[model samples]
Target: MAQLQLGPPPQQQQRPAQPGQPGQPQQLSPQAPRPPQQARPARPATPSDTPPSGQPDASRDQRRRALPGETVAPAPDETVIAPPRQRITNPTAVFSGLDKITGRIIAFDVAIDETVQFGALQVTPRVCYTRPPTETPQTTTFVEVDEVTLNGEVRRIYSGWMFAASPGLSGVEHAVYDVWLTDCKQSAPVIPGQAQSQPPATR
Candidate 1:
């Protein structure tokens, strides 16, 4: 019978590394690699996350700064207030007309609501306004003109504002007749038969 020999376990037996192969690299069993930590989803945005109202944005100021050799446009002024509109108070306006055939100039005063015949054109003063004595002298009149045809038909020809300072700027453009605003009056002329109103007593 051969003598019984004691030896180490087969798993612990070491194999000799081949020549010129230096040393054998250690083999390690791979662990499933923790399954990539499972990144948490980001929270959703809410109304509280919004910036406060009327607060200026930081990025806007940075963008407004001009770079080297770059042209920057000016921002519009939003606070420019417009002047208040004025009211018209006068009730009568004087209009001057020229007759081409007769070579004569005739001036007629028309009430704010009444119409006057200027040659073939009917002149009606709708509004008459005069600036205060403290302000620059200016008179504006809104006039309406109508023409009558041979067949007894009436038609509107011109309806617009005429300035006293610049009479030629807005006036009737006609071949036989021309009309323009000249002055503004407080009251219309009293007729021959109509009774004149008494002036108010001094306070």
Candidate 2:
């Protein structure tokens, strides 16, 4: 049986913080002022454009020299000056054969180092390249097929790079001889006694 109506509890009508006024000290709602930050347009400086993450990329000191599956290469100032090596000037290379027990299809011009036999198969020609009649006619002969054997034994069979645009792609697959690669010649079939050279007087 007790009733306490304390006198100071009635004086709490002091509430003027009413913007949203919950407990009274929260009147901070006036913020629509933030549209002033537009300045970021400046990237136009390329002599190559790489260096800057702590700054060190002069192309990592001109990175190049990592071939076999290459992570990256060719850039020592980006040096790719390889347009010079095209000199075969007619080193002669014409080959064609198939004399499988005399079914006879023989044709030979061989003369880069010159061997040329073609019955029991001799045919030399070490490198007789030819591409540049404005490119892509590609003749490539490297040849070297020995085979003398009846027990006379010479046997070297065939050796690489013969492709006058893929005559079976790399020749001399012999049962009786198949040979291939036909073209790339600067003259080598005039030998009755060899004396034919007269044509240079027209200015």
In the order shown, the candidates' Cα RMSDs to the true structure are 14.0, 13.4
> What is candidate 2's lDDT per residue for 167-202, written digit by digit as tens?
887746678777887788777665545787799999
Task: Name the 10 consecutive residues with the lowest summed lDDT in model 2.
Answer: 58-67
Predicted candidate 1 versus true structure: per-residue lDDT over 17-123, tens digit per residue: 44455576644336644456678998774534554588754445545676978755433322446575564578788888999999999888888889888778899
Clash number by candidate, in order: 0, 1
Candidate 2 ranges beyond 4 A from true positions: 1-32, 39-45, 48-57, 63-87, 91-93, 97-102, 110-165, 168-187, 190-203
lDDT of 2: 0.74
For candidate 2, the per-residue lDDT at 200 reads 96
Q: TM-score of each candidate?
A: 0.52, 0.33
Which residue pairs in candidate 2 collide?
A: 75-78
